[model samples]
Target: MAATAVLQPYNEAQYDHRAFDSLMDVDESAYYFDSLTGYEHLRSGLRDIFMRHGVSDELAVALLHRHFEMSTNEKLVELGPVSSPWPIAAHEDSVLGGHILPHTWRVFENELHPLEFRFIPQQEFQDARKVQFSQAFFEDFRQYVKANGLENVVGITQLDHGRDADESDVQLMEVTHGRNSIMVPAVPSSDVSGPAFQTIWSFVEKQSSKLDADGIQTRHGLCYKASSTDAANDGIQTRHGLCYKATSTDASNDGIQTRHGLCYKASSTDAANDGIQTRHGLCYKADSTDATTDGIQTRHGLCYKANSNDGIQTNHGLCYKATSTNTTNDGIQTRHGLCYKANSNPTTA
Candidate 1:
């Protein structure tokens, strides 16, 4: 609520009642009283009067003037302050980082979701016209979605409650999620029974559903990966069932697999052995060309080779550097002046 203001006494010497009389004739729908210099205090009381319960675009301007008179008339019954609240102003920032009545909000599945949204010009709020509200990602937010290759996001708003239809002024549910939900949230009012109060608060409360967070998401899991991580991570993250799509593929692999894989597992162990390799683990070959694909080489104490002329020869040079003058003979090597030859043929080794 706006803080109560410091009132000023009518100064009969400097100023006369003539100046205040002009304020009586102006209409209330869009009222702005002129300020005497250095008198910021006088503006607060008048400003408060304009900001009470939301004025609908459809409300008769004369009725609005009457309402204003009822609230501000000096001769009205002095029964003390009415059980009213501070008015919601267009530019005022709320504790929730948005407005009580968001600039533009959406409703889906009969639930209210207040958001800091905006609109494109049409006529006025009273005209049966349309506007845009942006969330998630879009080409450009301030521009009309139609202007930016998108259609308007369909939804509803309650101009009366200053909230979504589903949220009562005070929350009754005990929100729960470990430390994540124990924090206080800024609500419109604390009284649950308030005639026109609502909130988007966070509180500790028990949920009675048997399913986990997965169920509230209206999306089928096939489209996007739900974060087992953040509560709002690409999942049902808002009051209107704003679900971020799961990846088109189950990149998280949640509860989905090959149809054939599930069929075999359903059979009993006593059934005949399936004619397929059931072994499952990292498969490594004993001999994978005897070299790592990354170009790193490993070998035993002695090198080994497979030659067309010689099958699996040990202590052989698969590839080696020979820095010597060498000669070949019938399967024999002679001293420093080395000589080698095939056992059967002198031409090959």
Candidate 2:
């Protein structure tokens, strides 16, 4: 049968979040599926997945064979240890057409919510290739944590597009928790997708910390693109799953398009926020880089941070900044707020 996510079955054994995060990057050489022209590469990837799980060589081979059979077969049996007590051995489960396969594993609290993803900034996902994010990406992740249905999903760890060892060249990222987790495939070792990541959590605690409900700080920062002059995709576009910028000449080769800022992208269904700026610990939004005026900005949606000094620009203190309002000082002013008087208009004497 089909499972929500793509994964083999796992035993009743408990899984650790850190261990799962480590699995997100496919081994490239261990995978064996070749729907695409890159079947051998996928096979190599599958081999590494086996090693990551500490599966023996023979078992790995069996899994490969089963994967092949499953790839071709649709009416595979619905019974067998693949359900619960998944046997590490393929030969043990006879009901699985001699090829017992674990249910595909999908992250329940991942991707993005329909409502949330829409709010994503336009520039966030545009050029998925060259995205270097900032602290705001972490903040968005934190909001996702609060909005996530699964309480077990504490926070997102690292988002990368290449090798697991090189977090510097990271682009998109899946989340991590104490118990639940997800996996992603690797792109290339030499190429860093968007050599920049932003971490949005108080601290990286073990499962114990998440269970305790104690929170941590999120340190989010995007990578610095080497001096480059670009004009193709100087704007921003948030796509289905990635945040990219068509960086004109960044050596990192990440999809960087914006001129003066970094890029942060979320799943397709997550809220998108673009043109975010933090000045004096306050987040100010810009219409776009091309926009002449940068002063007109807005504030926190749904929730506001203690350090967030955001508000709409107004001529009076009733809004964000203190504005001067000239009143006759003789009308029925029901609105209670700071007021100013006309320059030459004298009152009753």
Candidate 3:
């Protein structure tokens, strides 16, 4: 007699099909696992089967999701065919840095298996998106993977989009090797209103200290000026009429006179002199003395001497050494102070 063949009914419960229902039905899925032994057995078997077929573990897991309607509920089991093959057509490649796409079944060229289909879960898709280029964080991630012996595995960085999405809805950043693409969240970093820039600035500031003692060479850093007065004044004041007093006893001068990366001096007595000075390499008066002597004296560079008390005094004067009546011999010399023409000698003046 010929051996009788028996066919068994597909037992959805055997491999935990209920888990798939939960995963498909819910917006998010939690991990499920059978007993420890079952988990090990399924994983080993699936890996062996895939290895024999020359499929990668990643691709194999994807195939399970695609063709078998199978998902890990802590262990692998047959869930039967829940859906038809959803092959991803080629030419849909749109990989960019800092972006994410929905996960789905796709066909890719495998080294051993020419054409292979894999189901990339939303999580795996998210993991792939987190890769950043040429960043310290990326280097750190590389070190971590190397240390953990997970060089082939991807790392994730969760981005918090408060109020816009649920607390659980975190965008991820992935770090992986051999990929020249970056996967970021769907939302642009510009759209997300958070302390990301501030955090970056803070990091830059920290790193800047090591590179230069002056710190970041930007004018955006904080600047604190000792008030002309010791009184607590924490309100905005007008830029003008708050000049630096030439005399040390000028008690009216009371507040910060200059902003960051600037300096102040009580030099300009011109009508434009507001008592405050800027290190903009502009000319200003050093004293109320006659135009012949008090000519424009810059806080940093050469001073121009006035020839007369008349308005022409502002025009007829040779540039002199700062704080001195001595004539500057250089022609067209540019310094961090006032701009003026130098006289060859006092006789020429």
Candidate 4:
């Protein structure tokens, strides 16, 4: 019997927008098949039909798995070919090989549609692995959401690779409110396959914050090798996900120099002559040696020594200039000949 001559079990009108919309309402439980044996039988039957129609086995298996996962009901059933005139059917109630069937089926006579199947070449599939994401895929997803009125809440569920060794990733994006979902290539079409999937994944991760439901969140930032001197001098940089520059510099002395952190010239010549002045702190002359009075005089009346001199000792005593040298002079004389009263009893000689 010719394949087209077979009577279609379901009506074409049954698989229209209404049927697709009905899919959005289906719960996750509908994806479970009755039994493993039943699933294998259904898969084998679909494989045979698909192969006979020139579809690759890998693609056939992938399509079948997707079909089963998105099926409105949980039962596994055998579906037969439809007649040429009405080759497509959307009604779910049909009996083939003593089993129930799905509401939609792609006819052998029709050209393959993107909505139904995707044929990725071996090289293309390999390329997708290196890619984390793609702008083309994002655009396609955006369009699909807009067209399907899924702008508000869209959920994407990634599935395992095919039963065979094919590592091609598959995902289904659906409107969370109803069963309006379809399987799409996890990576974008081959034309836009060079970008790593991580790039797009990150973008989604950052955008997820805006999503009410379980939508992907995308992160954003600048990435680049910063100029050794100034951030403003850094050249333009590009990244698929986010970009951020290294914010630290090699230490001048022993450790990393953070931005705006204290730093000094490390060269011995500069340190010996410049007296270890901080980039933004008080500058100490090289001749100063006293720890307390060795740097530039500050506003707090601390005397800074210029050439190792202790200067007037104002900390522990009161200085008083005497008319003449005498032990009765109420102040003790310092080695510099300045007289001052000590806080403790004065030492008399």
Candidate 5:
């Protein structure tokens, strides 16, 4: 039977989406206040409104003039604690790391005070309307998918509205989620043409369901002549599979028989027959007192086997050098290089 597939379609024009301008129209107009109570009420209302539209609490307070200003021109001649040494205004650095000299020095009670430095524009929001809307829409869609248990989704089809329904763009995507997903294509079929257009819904659907292709179970067994030493033989390395080894003369005379020649059996049996022994990681110099000291003498001089508890080990059974002696901790060292031994359970961390 053909495998079943799920299709999810979203039409942007059908939804009653709000305009970007409508969401960002913050009221910065001044309000009239006859009493202290009226002023407080107005301030509170403005703060709530600003916050509802994504404004931060600090920015809302600043906008309402509830926060104190440290760079005000009126503070130039104000009296401050004279105990601190007065540094020249030109020596002072602005927030931008630039040296800014004041316009003039105020003579307050015959004491000179720096006054009126250049004001630099602070950073503001840089996201464009289209980008912000795309991000918001994606986040909302992710939440919707999670809440509705659509985590097993295979693909997505989106229709973006243009000036008219006929000019709309259709986006098609085949997604495989592992660590994180990425955008493939957003350009509509109506806007562009060529090989790049094949990534659309129709093409992906056709490719995913193409027939006459062999499945894993129905695949044929691979055939090739054995190497002289039979060192790097390539065969079907799947579970429950077996390989037949034979000399070239015997193979030719036997007319390429199946399950005929000497059997190497499975991986473990074959590895043993090949005389491959546990390298135990390469021989490293280890002290006699070290726990990992193998005490075996070989052609590579005095070498020690890596500890089994070390986090990273080569197929031969040696621990990685960097894994043992990083900047943070000192691992066990002997004739065998540095060996890392976890004081605590590594799995818990």
Candidate 6:
């Protein structure tokens, strides 16, 4: 009798959204087989079918794994040529195998339609990675979301690279509640790849917010990025998510416009409008001159009580005055005391 391999029956949850580069040491136990002979026969059949059909060996193992997990029969019974659930592209070295299945697929009234597949060349994939992204990335992603017309991305799950990479740097990401995943790059980067997944999720969020019932950008300014620095120069800036930018200016004033919005001049008589100056060049705006509110609490605490008329008005509507004495604020105290903190409201030019 031939030695029978004790198969560790395929567990559906254990193999979700997995990616495998090579098939050299795939655990035979993870797959279901009646006998050692059955396993060998199945591998032979799969190898023959895949080789004849121009399927990569890596993808062959992946397809079988998927079939095993999804089928109710749960037996290694099929020896026929199997169509891949997803579009297949041949990798020169290893198959892009392992649970590369779609989370959901649509059927019409319980009738299965012929699925279409496309095989993109690996060189084209490499070429795509070189494209410079800024606004164009958002535009293309916006179109993708619009075409899919799917719901917002509710969650992001990282996938295992399956012995190909260390645990700290798995880059594959699955976007939940969306039509398909936002695949992370295969390259390992503990610092960049981890945050890249979050970036993708955030991009989805902004696009979804801008998308209306018709999946159009009819609701403007939701995910808006200033094409020119005109909006930033004018003190109208949106800081949330992808739209965040550092406040830079040529304006010589006590206050600076920032991503928070516009910083304006406050009335000195109203104690509520005056407080310690913050590093962003805004007054903390206290209701009363208490110990916490009156003292130099912040690093940019160049705040002082002075006449509103003594203040010089900024282009951004903020008030500033030249200080007589030096102070310990982050900026040079040659200019001192901002009257109001920046607000989310945009001022008209």
Question: What TM-score does candidate 2 reach?
Answer: 0.18
Position 67, candidate 2: lDDT: 12
Better of 1 and 5 by lDDT: 5
Candidate 5 total steric clashes: 14
lDDT of each residue in 1-349, candidate 6, tens digit only: 1232443332122122222111111112122222233323223432233233322212212211111121221111111112232323321212342212222111212221111122224444443211111232223323432343311221111112122335423223211111121222222111110011111110111122212111111000011111223344444333211122334453335443332232433323233344432332234545433323332221111222221221111110111111111222111110012122112111112
**lDDT score of residue 106 within candidate 4:** 24
- Answer with 3 or 6, whichever has the higher lDDT: 3
How big is the positional error of residue 228 in model 6, measured in Å on the Cα after superposition? Answer: 5.4
Cα TM-score per model: 0.13, 0.18, 0.16, 0.18, 0.14, 0.20
Put down candidate 2 lDDT per residue, 1-349, tens digits, no spaces.
1122333432221222222232211111112112222323212332233333332211211111111111111222223111112223222322322333222221223322110001112343343222222333323332433343221222222222212355433322221111111122222211221112211222222232111122122222211111111224343221211234544334255433322233323221121355554321223454433323442322211112222122111110000001112343221111112222312111101
Badly placed stretches (over 4 Å) of model 5 are 1-136, 145-324, 327-349
Give the 10-residue window scoring lowest on summed lDDT in candidate 2. Answer: 314-323
| Tens-place lDDT digits, model 5, residues 85-126 | 123232333344232323222122222223322222233112
In Å, residue 195's CA in model 1 sits off its true spot by: 33
Give per-residue CA lDDT, model 3, range 41-118, as digits (tens): 223433333233322212212211111232232222111111122222232322232222222211111101111112
Top-down lDDT ranking: 4, 2, 3, 6, 5, 1
> Model 1 Cα RMSD, Å?
36.3
Evaluate residue 37 in candidate 3 and report its C-alpha lDDT on the 0 to 100 scale: 28
Candidate 3 residue 180 C-alpha distance from true site, Å: 31
Better structure of 3 and 5 per TM-score: 3
TM-score of 5: 0.14
For 185-296, candidate 1 gives per-residue lDDT tens digits of: 2221111110110111111112322212111111000110011213333332211112222342232334331121122222323224432211111112223433342221
Query: After superposition, which runs of candidate 2 have C-alpha atoms over 4 Å from their true positions?
Result: 1-197, 203-216, 219-257, 261-349
Clash counts for the predictions, in order = 13, 52, 20, 31, 14, 1
Q: Model 4, 1-349: lDDT tens per residue?
A: 1243333232222233222233311111112222223234222332233334322211212111121123332232211211011123334333332212222222211211111212224444443321121233333333543444332222221222221334322222111011112222222111110111110111111121122111111111010110112224343111111122333334443542222222344444445745654321133454544434443431111122222321111111011111122434332222112223322221111
Q: Top model by TM-score, which number?
A: 6
